[model samples]
Each structure stands twice: as structure tokens, then as C-alpha cells.
Target: MKIFTARLRQTQFEISAANLAQCPPEQGVEIAFAGRSNSGKSSALNTLVDHGGLARTSKTPGRTQLINFFRMDDNCKLVDLPGYGYAKVPEKMKLEWQAHMGEYLEQRQCLAGLILVMDVRHPLKDFDRMMLEWSQHQNMPVHILLSKSDKLKRGPAKNSVLGVRKEIKAYGDQVTAQLFSSHNKEGVEQAREVLANWFGFEKEYETAQ
Candidate 1:
């Protein structure tokens, strides 16, 4: 599949936009990754692309302060948005990020979908709910990743996924979710499959061994 091949190929670092005006041209389909600070967004991106350093994982929350872009191909890209709900950051900076993200979500025509990362132990925080509501208003599809699932046992992890799915049902069929763990690489393929669909990637069977 081209998507699988693109994942294996080197993913180029595109640009970091501090605001909508600084962003690259809105051309092809783009899938954005967003979540609260300390939500494992960087780790999930690195794991999703099978590249260790594709997205920087920082110990400190709110370290990612810009909209980082990774080019999967000419027609497809992945965006890592600044994390929200980080109280340690300056209030001014927090408001700036909030404004930037809000404008991008509302006005970016090339945005195809959103992949929201949340800790499985604490899913559906206020910020997450707000994002869902905004996406619903925009008629945008969302695929949530319940990160750090390996911290919980299989039963509890499954329950968390079910709980999130149930809660999002109120938002209609546009929202979906799944359990994920970057450490064990759980749900990597599943996440990729969902992303591939968003980008309209067709699986190539002839190359199969």
C-alpha cells in the first residue's frame, strides 16, 4: 500500500507555524493530531509513522508550542498541533495557542480529519469534549486514540475504549475511538488503517509476500 510505503519511507519535517497565516499552503488533505499537554501526542505520532524521532517527545508539558508539520507525501501531510490545558504555560501563551488552533480548525479547508490523543485512564477531559464539539460543528470526522493503554490490563483497557465509544455516540457516527499504547505498539496498524482511509490510501495486495 502507498500509505504503508509512505510510512516506511522517510517522513520529512515540513514547517512549524505559530499561526494560521504562517502555515503552509492549504493544498492536499491533512490530518491533524491534537490533545491536552502530556497526552502522549508526540509518542503516538512517532509510533504511528514507525520513526523514533519523527515527533519530539518532551518530558515537560507544553513544550510543543507551534503547529508542527510532517510531510508524508505531496498530497498528504500530518500536523501536530500545540497541546492545550497546560496550566504551567504562561496565560498569554495559552490564549495565543487557543486562538491559533481555533482559527485553524475553523478556517483550514484542507483539513480532512482529526486524530485526538487522550490518556486512556482519563478520557474525555473538558478540553477533549470542547474539541469534539468544535469538530462536530465543522462536520469534521474524529478518531480518538486512548493513549497509554498498556498501563492498564486488557479488561480495563477494553472497558475504557468502550466507555469512550459510548460517550462519543452522542456526537453521531462522525466520531470514533480506539485503545493505543506507544510502548507496546498496540493499535499501530489499526490506527494506520483508519488514517489511510481518511487519506484515501488503497492497500496494494500484489506486493504481499
Candidate 2:
């Protein structure tokens, strides 16, 4: 088949919204990347797009407090959601963020799927389970990116993947996962293929020349 890939490399910073009302029009396919703070979500995003600085990576957790959007083209976009489970934030602010995120997740009609990132060493925490539950409620397709796979040995990493798969199996086929590493670009192609499929990129078989 002649693969028609989404031009993710050409993605540009679009806008940041603190609430759903402030976000751009809900028209295009948007795949959102979400995770707990310090899960390397931003790094994974940058790696997926082959852009070093697409999403800002920070040593401090909870750096992303807004919903950031990156435009791949006129009809496709990628969203960066604020990281959850940052302990230092005030309770009021945390609740506000949660409300905003919930609003977006429940109301956004054009959101195609969600990329849930987690550190390979600490996969499926309470926050991750909460996200999974939310996804199940929404019937949204979710791709779990087990980020920072390089930290663990191959056997352990594979085992982690298997464990995650088993844990999420009850959620149904709408949810899928794989190990990913921003540092080494592991599973970048696999992730991209998922995105491409979600975005409905053209797939045409090549005829005999």
C-alpha cells in the first residue's frame, strides 16, 4: 500500500487554552496527550513529531498548566493536556484544573483519541487508572505510551508492557499500549502509525508498476 503519512514534522504551535471555551473551534481530529506530572509527556510529544522543542520539557513537574494545541494541518491537530497529580499545587487550583480537563474531555466532539503517557517504571498509578476510567466512560480510543522505557532493562520493559496490556484488557480493544522512549525514539513509528490511523490519513494500495 502507498502510505500517506500525516505531516507531523510540519506541525506548528497553535494555541493554549486554559478552558474549553477558550480553545479553538472543535472541528478537526485532535489526539490529546495526557499523563501525570513528570511522566515525560512533553518529551514524548516532541519525539513523536521529530521536533526537539514542540512541547516544552521541564525538570519541574506540573509545568504544563494549560491545554496546548499543535496544528499538523488544517484538519488535524495534536493536543497537550496539563499533567495531573502535581502535589505542590493548591487544592483549589487542582480542582479547577480537573474541572476544566473534565469539561474538555466530556464535551469536545472532535477529539479523536487520547495518548495516555506513563513512566515505565511506575505504570498505572491511581491517576492513570482514573484516566482509563474516564476514557472508558467516554468510549474514546486510548493509546498508552509507557514512557521512559530506556530506564529499564529489555526483559523488565517487556514485562512491564505485558503487565500493562493485561491490566487494560478489561477496558476492551479501544485501548492499546506500547513502550516508548523519547531519548532513543523507541516506538516512534508505531505511535505515528496509530496517530495516522486515528486521523484517517489516506491508505491506498500501490498497483503493479
Candidate 3:
């Protein structure tokens, strides 16, 4: 249980498209967490780096209206894309999400990879599919963390991961299928290994740890 430590670091809200576009300039490496509304994305982020409650969690879907950025040690950034599948938000607002996310993913240069987290029991919904397609279109690397896997039994959980792996294989992504749990800290180390290797810092990470 020797987990890594990442403190609050710095968190800044980006409201306008202009601000979001300018975020990646300084952050040496960037990894993003994206999924449908209320998909446990924020919780996993807080758990991953041992920073509790980093991103706000809400029962209300689509609450994260803008792309929020949190800096770590002034070296890397954690990008939180807005949650899709809004039930109460206006049409114009939902439209804005599509445009904002589309622009960011397609244009960002320092985007090392994306953590496409999905609920294990209900992996790869419609909006998740669209996100996968976008990643393929942009040729972006993706690491899929099947969040909330602790809720499922061992047999079903592994089966779900296998199922998603087979389905998204055609995208030719350097993808991984791991189960995550904030409550019990499952998948924490494996995820760190994934990110460290993806960003070419695994050697340093291991050496330091």
C-alpha cells in the first residue's frame, strides 16, 4: 500500500473557450479524464494521486460545464472535460459542450493520453462510443479505467473488461483495461504504472519511489 502523493497543487477554472485553448502551453504533460455525466471521473482523479476530492462530485449530471484544469508540481496538468448527457441543461448549453470538447481534443498538442473512465457495470455508453471515435480520429492514446468495479463480483468484473477490450480493439489504440475503486483504492498502482509508462517517466518514477 505504498501509494504516491500529489497535493492540491493548483486548480484554476476555465470558463471561456479562449482560456481553455491557452491552458496546455506550460504543462509539460497532460492526461485527461472524460466520461458521461456523473461517471465517477472526478472521484477517480482524486483517488489516483492520493488527493481526496480534487474535482467536485455531484449527483446532478452535466454539472461540470467547463473544462477544468488542475496543475501538479507545476509540471503536469489534469484536464477535466465537461460531462455530457445532461438532462436539465438547456439545448444551447449541451451544444456548447460538444463544440468545446471537440475543439480541445482535436487541437491540443500536449495531450499525452486520455483516461476514458466508464462504470464497469455499464461500460461504453453512447457518448463513450462517440469519445472513442474521436480518439481514433485524432489517433490519441487512451487508457480505459473501468470505474466502480468494486460494485461488481469478481467474475462479472473481469468479463466486463474483456468485453470492452474486444469491442474497442479496432481503434488500434495503446489501450489498457483496469478496474478502479475510490472506496477501496483498487487499480491505483496499476494506473500509476500506466501513466508513468505512457509519459515516458516510469524509470524516474520507480527510481524515486
Model 1 lDDT per residue over 49-161, tens place: 88888887799999889999999878889999999998889999999999999989999999999999999999999999999999999999999999999999999999999
Which stretch of 10 consecutive residues in model 2 shows the poorest summed lDDT? Answer: 200-209
lDDT string, candidate 3, 68-173, tens digits = 7777645567788888886788998888788888888877778888998898998989988888888887778888889998899999999999999999887785
Model 1 misplacement above 4 A? 1-5, 203-209
Off by over 4 Å in 3: 1-19, 22-26, 203-209
lDDT of 2: 0.90
Q: lDDT, candidate 2, residue 190?
A: 90
At residue 27, give the lDDT of candidate 2: 79
In the range 71-95, model 2's lDDT, one tens digit per residue, is: 9888889999998998998888889
Cα-based TM-score, every candidate: 0.94, 0.94, 0.86
- Record all residue pairs in model 3 with backbone atoms less than 3 Å apart, i.e. clashing: none
Global lDDT of each model? Answer: 0.90, 0.90, 0.76
Q: How many collisions between residues are there in candidate 1? A: 0
